[model samples]
Target: MGAAPFPAGILIAAVVFHATVVLSSFPATFHLERGITANYKLKLSKLKERDRVRHGRMLQSSGVGVVDFPVQGTFDPFLVGLYYTRLQLGTPPRDFYVQIDTGSDVLWVSCGSCNGCPVNSGLHIPLNFFDPGSSPTASLISCSDQRCSLGLQSSDSVCSAQNNLCGYNFQYGDGSGTSGYYVSDLLHFDTVLGGSVMNNSSAPIVFGCSALQTGDLTKSDRAVDGIFGFGQQDMSVVSQLASQGISPRAFSHCLKGDDSGGGILVLGEIVEPNIVYTPLVPSQPHYNLNMQSISVNGQTLAIDPSVFGTSSSQGTIIDSGTTLAYLAEAAYDPFISAITSIVSPSVRPYLSKGNHCYLISSRVVLRCGALAFRKFRVKG
Candidate 1:
């Protein structure tokens, strides 16, 4: 599958919550940064590499406690390989910049004793570590803990018999990995009240304190404290908070893909009059969507529905960690044919590094289906 730029609009993912709450609404919102100088090819390759690895396996309360942290990184995965946010952890909280990834479970940051963890980042952000010894509130998650059992069930963490510590080792498709033990500590943020009012708050949450990093994670380029997983597993921050009744069982985000590159992520649902709801493929490890068909310029492409079916090797996954949209070969062929047929007359279409590229004049408006591209080279 080849990569294509994400469609222009707000990207929202709202998972259904089984329980209902009757408290005052607290909407925790934050901003995200997009890397403007990241290597596009490198980002695209990483996305594909991640997809290959993914086929193998797979917020708040208060007042109804909604906690908001400042986010950094871009909405466009092509422009920036990742989007991250700063989390305040431990007592007398210290800032830790962690990648915001929806693909994997468990929130982890480098620990004081971490080895192979980059001390600097090419992203131009300061990297910090979480020291359990320094935080009086920080506690090691015992192997016998219920959370440890859950983590083991989800392939998120391991239980050591000798020390009885709950630890984790997560491997990425790009060969990057991080390993650490779980720690219960204070996670600080701003609690939003009535949407506008803000109050300081802290919650005890279980997160990984990374002791080792490997592969791309060890590189100074694009390095951060660690990753903040927004996955559906029980060990994710979302599930931890929901279990404690501090927040609802749902979360949402609106990503901006413009040059300014900022977005809003909330711990609760966004009630918009025009919002549409879609059912998620149930019991899947990843956020798999049941996509039935593809449409180009109001004309439906003649692709088989089963091409988008869920299986060990096939399924439609909505992964924010990925930089571009990937279509199965069956769907990709017709999709590219449709788009090229529409704009071929106005531009020179060719193959560049396995992607379909189009060189067009500044005045040419490249339109495919409902999407319009202008003033730049188009690649897919």
Candidate 2:
């Protein structure tokens, strides 16, 4: 049938090939700053690339992670009000919601009935973020600006009677989400190089203006506006940094809660302490090498055929968007048993037929060789 089992010799060869590919790729797991804007073409291509990794019997989910997004500024005490994974463009900062999605690129927000768009809402939707006089010399994204096309696609906007573009839409994520647009006259922040409020007066911050709607929507921010798309896309906030000569491929994030104080996000390199970091090799530009084989508790079980089938070769990806490790059915038993033993036995694991490979206890410890997955607990 399927190419006649590849003959014994060929099958052995395939096994060797499998090991070689992963093993060889292991050494390539570090970020290289190869000059900003220079490697952007390379980054964009990988995001759009179609070939997916298939391992043994499992096909890795075709999800891309956009881990770098600006911490939302909330009208309420920011550190307290900001609970959503994503931020909307139009809703009040304290009430916005966004998905920490790794599946698609582009960060978008929902702007209900927006028009005359610009920054966040793109072009079609409109949002009001300006003084009619437009005395702010900092608003640089004009109808004839090249950045609009470079970051955002283009607008189908015609002039309103006042001869102004009206408002704009900032579309970052996919159809799964939307963000209206607003123009931050400038993007300002405390300098990383020097401790001063550095201002990019000419730079316009275009965001996905969104509204927090109902039904399975992110629960943290019901009164929020929209999400911040951190996925890899040409129009992402990370991608917009090309002007400052920053690399889009090299980025990181740390989400801190009420108790832990906080964490830091390193865009180029990780300079933090005490974090057991896993070095990943970027296969091309934006994509990293996935793992195909796993050994738990010193025992190797037959990988689930459901993962890829006996003949496939894609591997497991370490996703920041996903909070848990996804294992095939073959790998589930030992995976759970090992975790249960280390974590509180009160924790319970779940298997949802064809749905989840296994719903791991909310937080649990997972030990693999020298690497340990801590903060392990179970949610009901």
Candidate 3:
């Protein structure tokens, strides 16, 4: 089984626990990134697919908003792409599917009267718009509220001219953005109590109520209800739960490579596993890691030493939103050359635009596959 980059940093393979208490079930909704799989089986070029993946990651990483609530869900690796989970927002508790990403923070959903929001989606899930008026528990956050000011990282908080509601404008690196205001409402989800029994739970969360969207955010084939950011921060769902003593400060997710629909996400620590721990780079935005060097088949790649330097600005972030591994130009050239040189004789390499495509047997696939994952020690 191939291991991908996980921000959570632990892998608990094939462990099932029986509950003495009511176990919470936060079932994850998994789907491939755009172009990974098509229900109609339409063939897309490799370059196009790569672009779609890149675009998705750029959007996912650039999400900035204000919301907090811990959620648990698992994803299927059938398509080997992105994974998402469903969240219930509002008093009646309408379900909305959002991408499960650790690179960004804050959870925002498309609200009613949203401009450029997708009317339909290819994932076959109904994209419901949230209306604060419909939910009895929902209320608009005022500009003078402490939660609204606490969530703002900088001077980006813009209140109404009449001192009414607080507004937020979340922008991406690619110029795409979401403009909305803040709202507070109850979020419904399943919480594990003791062992086997699951309990229904609800939390009061503050999240972005998007009124307008631009650029690729408007697409239908690749659209979902919105995005859920799981990044480490005071406003993230995990931190919010820890503050309330609802759960511990640690979490884990086990994503199965097989499409068997068997995966697990635990919000608290698992005491049985004696896994070694690595220190995280402190005060960084994402799950940044100081990768020492790159090794291939017992041989380390000869590259510039500064390329792997551990710094706040120049480290690697394990992002689940990314569809494939992206290396810097200095690393990409040498890595590609080494791999292609070894397999050139056996496999006839062809190009779909600039991408190298090859046909190989099952044996070669196993030999070339690499496994990598991250583990973190969550402390209160």
Candidate 4:
């Protein structure tokens, strides 16, 4: 089967749109911060003001064109997709900056008793822990309650009658994990009305208040208030708002390159005439897409179709939380070989960790129209 072509005149912009948080306002905008690098330092590059705007689109697109909710985001040289939004929590809401992730379901924040929570961040921004006791609107979720059952699976419902506080435990692929209980409180953010005009609104949202963290979550430089999960799970802030009839329960984001300030995140269906819609793989926990072929510079790599087939444990997942792209061994070898065979021998190639790197001190310039993603098309 042939892949559906994108609409004519529709430029598939490099800015990838996604969503991670939901607000009470019809259209809301949050300024994002590029997360700190693993080395605990901020990467700043000086560029011409016109060059910045030329290579990147500003929050001005939030109201018109292909964008709606225009949220400004900072740049992180280390991790390209680490975007966060600053919002308030509690009766008299205190501001917090939390990383936006789409691979998980729960919205969790480090609490006052966080054992491994960081006190400082490399982003040069102040970090604060959530104090549930300080918020009069805050309430503990009990294990016996229906909301607790909503969070747990039928087989995992082992509630303690003696202590009814609903508990949550989450583990990441990087050997990092967090454990804590749940709480409901007022979540506040601004809604974009017209152009930069925003109005404030608040809603009661149930989120995890983590008290313990391990691995990178404990690192002060990488830690923020917590993570805002925007997965498809019903427990996500998006689903919670939709269940309450908040605003049709939809959202989108446009992820910009490092040179750009960041991209827009809107809360509605995007109607792009030039957009091509692909069917998602069903019965999967995460967003999985069917990949048909792989190509580079318009040349399809010589690889078997079975190499891309789904196994019991491995499959194609579209996760924004992931910082890098990894190809299976069968496909990676030929992919690199093809690229190296075409390059000039004058540029010496060396192995750097797991990558084939070239030593180029001279400024090599390519035209704006040059370079393209793999020619492999995706189909059902």
Candidate 5:
């Protein structure tokens, strides 16, 4: 797929935290770092592997109250593509490194009794498990809880007959899955004050304690402790904090593209005057956007508007977990044709393993600019 124009920063909601909060108070922001260190080819290959599985499936508050997390990982899609941050959980605060994904809703970690959880990681990070027995503040969520009811409706959660625990079994499109129960504990983070001073803070959060893993999740090649989803659901960490009035109900992120990968993930809205806004498809399970048309080098492609429409199984979704962009089958041909038509005469375009490959010489100058998308409204 051709490269699309990306905003300097992304804001999920319109209300900026700074404008909403009082002058005496500030909202908390979570800072995240990229964690991948794999080579370019390996990362690209992993992206393809993840894309194959993912195409199948598919915050906040306040205070002079800014929560920031120190992130680790690269932002370059060709290099280390996945970004993760450290979370201190439980009573005594055990550290867990989780991938920051905007595609799913729950925040889960490998538990002490987890079967098939990786003991070590190829990413060079020490793997740790969340042992509920070790944390004094940890408690298992029951099936009767309201959160569990919501989980049952929105996710793969079910009530276990034995002990009446809220158990979840998440199956990905790639055949990988995880089964576990819900656990509530304190999530530790750093609260920034006066834009310079930092203070430690903690909040009660509901998260998964994975007891079993299968498929790619069991592999140590690119493993992490768990996944921290920045989704728009009650079970997500962002919404949990927002319901508690800890921060605004929005989040923003800016991924740095340099080799030394690090970026900012704010639990609150980012105040940017130059940011463009697009309406999200309402009440959808994923972050679906209404894309009306595609433009290549100021020329619009002759693709149907319905190609990007929201339906039960079709829509344009923005997912952070996915490193590569995927076009719908209906728009693929037109997009490729437009891209190829604009290429220089010296450059050669070929097909390799079902992928559109381009061979351009060092001497050739390709003046390709932004691939723009026009957003249109869709009636619910």
Candidate 6:
């Protein structure tokens, strides 16, 4: 079924908005570097004063549009959806509007002062939720915290000191913005599932934690709460899932939108036959399924990774947050040309946008060796 991918932030993320966010977060980043030797640097790109307001307005209703699609279906047990949060900053001792990221391992929210401040200066919560101020051990870490001495290589003394505060800086895509540190706190997550499809079960996991806030975009998302890092580390959220026997690789997503609330994130292996399949065995520790080759009706494109300034091999990452496949120019060109041959130029643009777009009136097929995915239209 056709589905609309992410619908957020249209215009360039504005400069005024980022200026405030950056200035507010800048101090924490500085404070962090002094106490801890920077290891995995948060590689951030200079934020271009883009049309951020346009994008923010569009994204305001991002989750609403996907709900209109008509393919109500079942998701593989390993596939699940993400719960995203958008927030603001500047206020303290309350909910700092924050951007929630699950792909990360750290479990933190904005400190009460730093957390709710970003969200309309309004932090909404139910009764059982945490009150950052009164919560246990809720205080920013000083430069002298043991986390710094042990050389934890975390966000620094700011994040490690008080066991409650951790300075942080993280980056996403090349064109995407960046965020800086605030403090640490807990977070919450909810999963859904059941039935003979017993391999998958869903429940809500609440992380009563907070994290430092940061982001270059005015509202690229709310001040970042803690990241739900899946990597190895005691503080990783995966620790929580493993306790309940939830496997990591067994995850997927169908975020079509609010109407159906999209798909499930299976914590174990799940195979779905109907949703086109590509038998990818993966290249070692990559954990990623391999894309050995791509061909149209047998003839392949002369794909050279060096030309595009990227590896020529099919080393693509499967990310839920990414709306479409973003191929390096070298790879994208030939694929577009080959696919262009299958249909009129009019339909080529959409196909170039992603692997899922319609093929128009033409028949299109993509193959990975013997396995292939073909698209055809059936009229009622």
Q: Each model's TM-score?
A: 0.75, 0.44, 0.70, 0.72, 0.75, 0.44
Model 1 gets an lDDT of 0.72
In candidate 5, how many clashes are counted?
26
lDDT of 5 by residue, 1-380 (tens): 21333453432222112223245545654444334332322334444434333221212223534455656776454445578888999989889999888888899999997899999987788999999998889998999887787576576688978889998888764578898999999998765433433346788999999999999889887789998888887888888887876655667766766567767776766554577889999999899998999788998888888788789867888887655566776677778788789888877876554567667876653222122222233444
Tens digits of per-residue lDDT for model 2 on 21-128?
Answer: 334565754443334233233332322121111110121111222122244222123233332343222222222334343433444444444332223321122233
Residue 264 displacement (Å), model 1:
1.0
Each candidate's number of clashing pairs is 14, 71, 14, 8, 26, 77
RMSD in Å for candidate 2, one decimal? 19.2
lDDT of each: 0.72, 0.36, 0.62, 0.63, 0.73, 0.35
lDDT of 6 at 280: 38
Which of 4 and 6 is ahead in lDDT? 4
Candidate 1, residues 1-380, lDDT tens digits: the string is 11235554533332222334534556643334443323333344444334323321213224554545455676443345567788899988999998877888789999987899999998788988789999999999998888787687578778889999999888985678888899999988765544443445778999998998999889886788888888898888888877876665667765666645556565655554477989999988888888999888899999988787888766877776655566777778888889888875868776654667676866663322123221221123
Deviation of model 5 at 242, angstroms: 1.8
> What tens-digit string does per-residue lDDT give for candidate 4 at 311-353?
5566677665554455776677788788777777775556644
Q: Any idea how many clashes model 6 has?
A: 77
Q: Give me the overall lDDT of model 3.
A: 0.62
- lDDT, residue 152, model 2: 40
Put down candidate 6 lDDT per residue, 1-380, tens digits, no spaces.
22354344332221231222335653643222222232422211212112222222322221211101112221221122233332221223233222223334344443344432244311232112235456443444434544322214433223433444434444554243323333333322322223211212332232324323334322322223333343334344454455444434333334444433443332333343357655534332222344545577688778753432213343444444433345555555676577567755655335333343443345763312111122222122
Greater TM-score among 2 and 5 belongs to 5
